[model samples]
Target: MLRLHDSAQGRVVDVVPRVEGRFSMYVCGPTVDNVPHIGHGRFTLAWDVLRRWLTFGGLDVTYVSNVTDIDDKIIAAAARAGRPEVEVAAEYEAMWWEAMAGLGVLRPDHAPHATAYIGQMVAMIEVLLAAGHAYRIDDGVYFDTSSVPDYGLLAGQPLDSLRAGTRVEPNDQKRSPLDFALWKAAKPDEPRWDAPFGAGRPGWHTECVAMSLELLGENFDLHSGGQDLKFPHHENERAQAVALGKGFSRYWVHNGWVEVEGVKMSSSLNNFTSLTDLLARADQRAYRLLLLRAHYRAPIEVTPETVADAERALERLDAVARRFRLEPLDESIPVRRSDHPEIEAAGDDVRAFVAAVDDDLDTPRAVALLYDLATKANALADGGDTEAGHAAAHLLAVLAGSLGLFLRGTDATLDAASSALASARDEARRRGDFAEADRLRDELVTLGFVVEDTAAGTRIRRA
Candidate 1:
């Protein structure tokens, strides 16, 4: 059983306890107005890990994530670029796919775009209107919060307080301050689609509600996004579903924001860092490790120093994985690490690590536990304790797999960098620079190779 906290209910619940073989999950995707930042990378990778862990545990998972192609931001971007709406959305959406693939994110099972799901969004809004939960005002349709008695229940904000504290721009066409737009009327020279409410476009909050219902039905296993989305965005999403008089989601997972140098990362504050820019300076492995260094729920502070630390940490992890000739443990073996006394001593710590991961994905704690196991495993390997060494390697691989940090033996690509280094050494030796050649030979061996200057030739192994 997985314990997941429903942000709506503010309590943890068993997500798939009684389910048979399949699980459904929905995550809020990018809006496609701008390039994604390192903060978005954190949520994307974390959810990808969660999906992998559940699948590894023997559940068939069907994941659906939506792309919000039609939004005010997209409209603004189009105007700024002097381009058509579809052109702007298409360009940015392509960039999104490229960036995510570069970071090793598995494409979602169903990536429904808002423009593609306009019919569903319209139908859902029509249902809300027919159910007397929404009203079509002069030039727009707005969800009437008064109709839903449990308004603000999802976010735990009092309705009275929300009404008082809410700020509205000059052009908001709503009957009440608490009411939110379901569809906005078209403006001159703006991107517009013909909806039931004349020529207009779908509101931001309605896309996820409709897409989730269309793909996963009324209720799904999980709904995930950033912590900042909890208030108005997700809060309004739940209200739209409950207005249909049915359950929506069982669990809501929100990852905390990434901070920079002790301040919240934001474009307005000029403290933001783009993932693409960071990737230029660091490899994908190092970029991911920086985010995984902190727990998902805690605010992560990103700095050049922090990124450098993550690079060193990832190198250490790769060094250990390289040392072990890892193979998948047999399912029939019961995966018993307790029989070995060394592993038995580490059992409590291992259990704690798994528990933290299972308990809302405490990745930082799990990472610490992994480093501890690595130290013990290295010591055992040096002492020639095969049984204990194998046990430690097995446990470390399992934990590392949960973080998407392990390199399986089957998937090891030829190290082009290493091959290039060897060629460079051969060239140096041919040029009679014996001093440089000798330094390169030592460097190659230190990098997990058995470089031999013999009559036969140089060789490499699992050093």
Candidate 2:
């Protein structure tokens, strides 16, 4: 059994142990209009860590994320790029998958594309309309927020207040300002599909509700996304699900936004940083650490210095990973309840971290716990107790697997760096520059290599 922080209740709820231990989870994935940015990466990494811990805790986890291939933004982006909508969406979606895989995120069990589920979305909207939960506007279909009594519950906004604060372009067709679109009418030269209402496309919120229900049933385990999604997006999703007479998502999980120097990273502000840009400049593992440093709910203020710090920390962790004999740990170790106290404590910390995650996806606390474990294990290794060292090492391996951090293998780039260092040393030695050789060896250590001199030969290992 594990305690999960419930975003809906704003409290921790203990999930009862089931024989099958199946846990269904979903994260609101990207609208495949453009390549993802650092903000997008931060959310993905945070959830990847959470999923790792859940798997660590011995849950039969089935994770799903959606690819929103059809949206106003996607159409606009396609037009802006002078490409077909399908071509643009596919290109960006392919990039999203490649970038995520390179960043070491485990591919979700299911990745349903919105375009593929047009029939389901249309059917779902039809159900809502028949139930008196939606209304057809002039040229489009709009969800009637007034029909749902608890319209803004998830957003913590009352009905009238929500309507007042909400911004819908001064439109006379909408029954209320808070009412969001369910289907948008097709425009000239835009992608369109035949629907009962008209030839149109799915609204942004409609796909998730339809996809989640179709994939995970009316009720599922978890729903996660960026903090910005809580209002309008998630809130609208909840109302849609409720209107469809389904339980929707059980737990609402949200990771906080990435801030730059204390301001939210926004396209409007021109403060957004693309994922490709960051990956180009730094190692992927370093980028993960930068995100893991903060609680998921706490806004992270990223700068060049902070990213550099993350890169250095990753080097240290990579050194530790390289020292280990790469092997899968014994299946005997229970991810949730282990015989050893240390193991149990580690599991507890994970539970607490995720419970905080359950609270609102408190990723920073989970990150802190990870660093604590890494520090303790490293300290134990430093003490020269090889048995404890092995155990600690094993723990780190488990944590890495569970949290999707510290991939314990040789990256080709790192290997090339080692080869270059060796070549540099060899050149220095051939020049009879003993002083230069020593300096090069020292430099290799800073680059995460371990070097030792012996009577017969010199040995090198990743530091």
Candidate 3:
């Protein structure tokens, strides 16, 4: 059985699925008001690693992540940009997907946008209000935290401790400081949805409650997001579930924060560097490698020195791939250990990788094992232990693929922008516009793409 750290249980526990022979997971997604940052990518890759591992292990998985398309942040950005809220959301959501694709993250099976589920959210709000779990105020409706006895289960604290830490709100109408909004009454020129209480929009906490239950049914297998959401955002979601007497997520998992320099990354810090900018300056795969180097729940710092180190480490892996002529492991291939007969002789390496990965996705140790296996593969081959050498190399590729690291057949990884430029330059060349083609190649070079023209076409990589 896979064991994971449960934020609600406050410990690593065996994963007992709500149903037999299946897996269900719900991860919180972006708000889509602005371009995603490295912090966003970190959370994204962390969950993507988990989803890939589950599927790689041959379990049928259903992944659901929600896009908060109509949040306060989106409304604010729309107002500032003088555009419709929906238009602002559509623009940034496009930016989000382009970034995710560049990082090779898989799309969720179901992406429930907040705007599409306003009706469901309103229905849930009605249930909460009918059961006396929520109350209306001058500005909006708020969830009464005291109604749920175990309100702080996912917060890793008792109700009193959770209440004590709440930032005092100027809205004194709230029953407790720990209480949160269920619906926000429309402000002037803000998007509004009609509800029994009034015309207002659903709160951030309510969307997941409705979408997860509707899509995954009650008592879904896992609910995960960044550690920052565990406190109020997720806690409020769980509270509503309990108040209405519904079975919620079985296990709660939250990844640690992404740090910049020595400090934690946050928009308030004015340091949410756009993921687009970071991908432009560095290899996209290097960021993925850097993420794999640390434990998912451990806070990781993103710095030039650290990223450069990760890039060098990837070069070592690529060198082995080039020497052995190894092909990239197909991600869709089954990850059964027995399928690879070569690894049967390399049992120790296989066992070591599985042992580390089984323990809360201990990727740091698992990645170290791959490095050690690659070294052994090269040395054994040079020493005439051909059978053992090839086995080690085969196991190394499989293990990295299991962790969603595709090491073979890669030049420098390219961002969406550079890749598009490479395509456009090819079209320019085909039209016999040599000047424009040269200009495009120069642009790619300035963005760190190694532009090469061949008899086939221009090849570009942004490592």
Candidate 4:
């Protein structure tokens, strides 16, 4: 079984499934108003890793992440461009998927769009109104935070404290500063849906509550998002479920933020770095490796230096794969220690890796264990123990694949010019001409190849 840090509990706890041998999870998806940033990339990768690990453990996982096609941000962007809101949402949503595919994130089992669930959201709001959990002001229907006793449970604060810290808005008719709109009245020339309350659109927080309950049902196994959503967003989602006398998520998981120079990277702060730009310049796998090398709950600083370091680490893994002629492991297939003789032979290391990952998805520690396995495999191969080296390499590939890092046995075919440069560099080293050897190695690097020295000879691969 896996354990995770549940935001509602404020500590790590066992993730006991609602049903035997099955896991259901709902992660908040992008708003689709602009290009995704590093923060978006981090959250999506964190949950994707968890989902892959759960499946690798032989559990049936149903993942649902919703897209917010209708939001204030979408409307604002549309207005600025003099385009329809739907067109803007559709364009950005396509870019969102393109970026996710570049990062190798698997599509969710169900991606419920907010526009498609308007009827359900309206019905839910009507139920809340009839139950006195919501009230209608001139602007729109608002959820009364006072209706729920534990309104701030996800925020980990008392109601009084939250109210004190909240900034006052222009809606003076709101009963409390903490009260949030369930539906916002449509402004002139804005998109509107016909509701009994008025012609309006759903609030940013209402769509998730409606979609999750509809797709995963009550008390789904886990609800996850970035730490920023822990506040009024997730808390408000939970309150709606509680007010309706229904169960919400059994566990709440939030990944930490992406920080640049100690400040959180976010579009609102104008400090965000685009995910597309990073992918365009660096190897996409390097970003995933960078995320895995750090604890998911700790802030990560992503710069060219960090990405370059990850790329070098990836080169080492690929080198081991090439030396052993290892093939990529398919993570969709369930892995068991008893099924593979190599896994059983490498029992101690495999067990350590599992232990690290099982404890709240501690990927940093697990990644260190992987590097250790790679080193042991390479040393065994160099010591004339071919069989033992192959077994260790097999173990390394399987374990790394479970975390979604696939090692390739071969890179792009080395061109004739680059190959000759590598051979000449090896000859220079053999002749003890250090300066010439360094110069040739730099030349190969400039040709977009990573040059490495091995017991056999110089090994070159694409950078």
TM-scores, all candidates, are: 0.84, 0.84, 0.87, 0.92
Backbone clash pairs for candidate 4 read none
Indicate the worst ten consecutive residues by lDDT in candidate 4. 330-339
lDDT values for all models = 0.76, 0.75, 0.86, 0.89
Model 3 CA deviation exceeding 4 Å by range:
331-345, 409-463
What's the C-alpha lDDT at position 253 in model 3? 94
Q: Which 10-residue window in model 1 sums to the lowest lDDT?
A: 331-340
lDDT of 4 by residue, 159-190 (tens): 99988887877478999988999999988999
Please report the candidate that would top lDDT against the real structure.
Answer: 4
Which candidate, 3 or 4, would have the higher lDDT against the true structure? 4
Candidate 2 on 1-463: residue-level lDDT in tens? Answer: 4555566777667654223577888899998877788888988888887776677666778889999998888888888989898999999999998889767777888999999999998998898889888899876899999988887777787899876776667588778888888998887787899998999888899898888888888678889898889888999999998887888787887777889888899655778888888888887777777777676677888777899998887766655555554455443222442323465545655566556544434555665665676676668767877556656566665554455665444444557667777777877777889899899898888888777553323446664
Candidates 2 and 3, the one with greater TM-score: 3
TM-score leader: 4
lDDT of 3 at 263: 84
Against the true structure, candidate 3 reaches a TM-score of 0.87
Q: State the RMSD for candidate 3.
A: 7.7
**lDDT (10s digit) by residue, model 3, range 123-198:** 9899899999999999899999999988788877889987676677647788888888999998878899888899
Clashing pairs in 3: none
**Is 3 or 4 the stronger prediction by TM-score?**
4
